[model samples]
Target: MTDTPIFQPGDALASARRTLLTEAQAIETLAARLDDAFAEAVRLLLACRGRVVVSGLGKTGHIGRKIAATLASTGTPAFFLHAAEAVHGDLGMLTAQDVLIALSHSGASQELLTVLPAVRRLGAKVIAITGNPQSELAQLADIHLNGAVDQEACPLNLAPTASTTAALALGDALAVACLEARGFGPEDFARSHPGGALGRRLLTHVRDVMRQGGAVPRVPLSATLFQALEEMSAKGMGMTVIVDDANRPAGIFTDGDLRRLIERRGDLRGLLAAEGMSRNPRTIAAEALAVDAAAQMDEQRLSQMLVVGKQGELIGALHMHDLMAAKVV
Candidate 1:
């Protein structure tokens, strides 16, 4: 008989669904298997004084690199090393203070086994992540994280699928746990990711980018439209805040308001600031996050807002331009 199989509708779809279920079920099993060994690995990682050096071969190596990156970005210092390259002098990077994480799906990767002894000799403890907890790699490790899965998504069951997924999930769990224990917060994450939108939202506070001091446009409620217009022009923020006797904001007269007044009154040059201004304008705190300010402005369909102090006194002014300049928009 010929080896070629017959084609059919939905066959590929059926296979894909089966594969996903297999891999997802594998992770569930791994979660159930989590025991003291997992805790021990976490403790060792937390106690490590130096970096986490991850080493693996082949497909395991790809997973190892991703794990190392996640750990590093989340506050756990980590870097990836190839087991094949370690024997060639890369092992020198490991020291007693560091923790060596070895990933081997079969628990019998020769390249990894070849360098384990050398790393151990350097005083570094080993944490093995493998599918076979009873294998030689596991036996040699100071701690083992069981990454066992029943079978791979490959129809032939020869390729690494469920195993690699389990390994990656376990790695993420470890990184997040360490992150929480260390009190790593958004501000710290922003420091590491200074170019991302999330970084701008967290690191760029309202006060850092607000127009303050004399740069803020202000006019007494008793000021005429002509006087308010001059204040707005001088401040260059396109708006002027009208303050009450207590120095709290009572209203705002924007260039938009001036245009509307000209259209309706036909003689705004003689009107008082209070008669032409929008009353009880939206306001934000000077210490609030720039992200919150952006959200507030977007929600209100506003282009400019007044920044206030804790006691509701106007301290600064911000426009959509300011948020854009700060890269928070």
Candidate 2:
């Protein structure tokens, strides 16, 4: 029988770290290799009227999915279509207006090559990303991007380690370039990813989540403290807006105010709303983005903010709870 190899803890850990560094280096090399072809690919995708369809097999499929997601989220409309599935009628997803980016390290994935004729017949331009420029797929493509790696991180040199990572990084580069070329902004990204964290940060404006007029509890300066409590109870907003004679927001009275007033055994009926309400309450603009409001609230340690117009009129009110539900917090 063959002898079993001895394991050294330090040696094994060091080897793994070296492999990770090698993968990182592969990505950097791919970045340096980018040329006019990368720009041409971006232009082809932006000119597409339908979508960018990414196809791959094996580990390449995993990277393809991520690349498609990044492209879609960043403004380039794209989706992943398994090479095997394309032969099984999924090819219907592609159209003349679409562009196809096929991924394969060897550039000889059987499923991919089988659909090349149909892909061309549909008038869809194919961009091949592979390690071999002389491969059949590369020769068939309208454009080819070289994603070669000198060696893999795997000691056996059999696993797709450094090569797959390089491909993924290259895909990200393409996505970002296309995003910039399209002038896609945060608002566009938000629209594409409405359920994601980025959407909450960019699309959730103050007007969408803020409590509006009539729903906001408020009382005149001449009203008694007992009257403010009744208003707060009825509105269920946990606070009452204090407005000036011109209906401008003066300050606010909250649950904390109630606690302080209660601690002093203050006269609930005798005190006026102007006396009990805070005069320098935190406020935000009705047009302010939710992200900015969240930052302001965190910096000031305030639980809620009064939304006002340019004239300081009480337009709406926002609570920390609204931000929490919107996932902006």
Please give the CA lDDT of all the candidate structures: 0.91, 0.90
lDDT of 2 at 30: 88
- Candidate 2 lDDT, tens digit per residue, 52-132? 999999999999999999998898889999999999999999999999999999999999999888999999999999999
In Å, residue 139's CA in model 2 sits off its true spot by 0.6
Alpha-carbon runs more than 4 Å astray in model 2:
1-8, 213-215, 232-239, 244-247, 254-269, 280-282, 309-313
In the range 59-172, model 1's lDDT, one tens digit per residue, is 999999999999999999999999999989888888899999999999999998888888788889999999998999999999999898899989888999989999999999
Candidate 2's TM-score: 0.85
lDDT of candidate model 2 versus the reference: 0.90
Question: What does the lDDT read for residue 260 in candidate 1?
Answer: 91
- Point to the candidate with the largest TM-score: 2
- Which portions of model 1 show Cα errors greater than 4 Å? 1-9, 212-224, 230-237, 242-251, 259-266, 271-275, 278-285, 298-301, 308-315, 324-329
User: How do the predictions measure up, each by TM-score?
Assistant: 0.83, 0.85
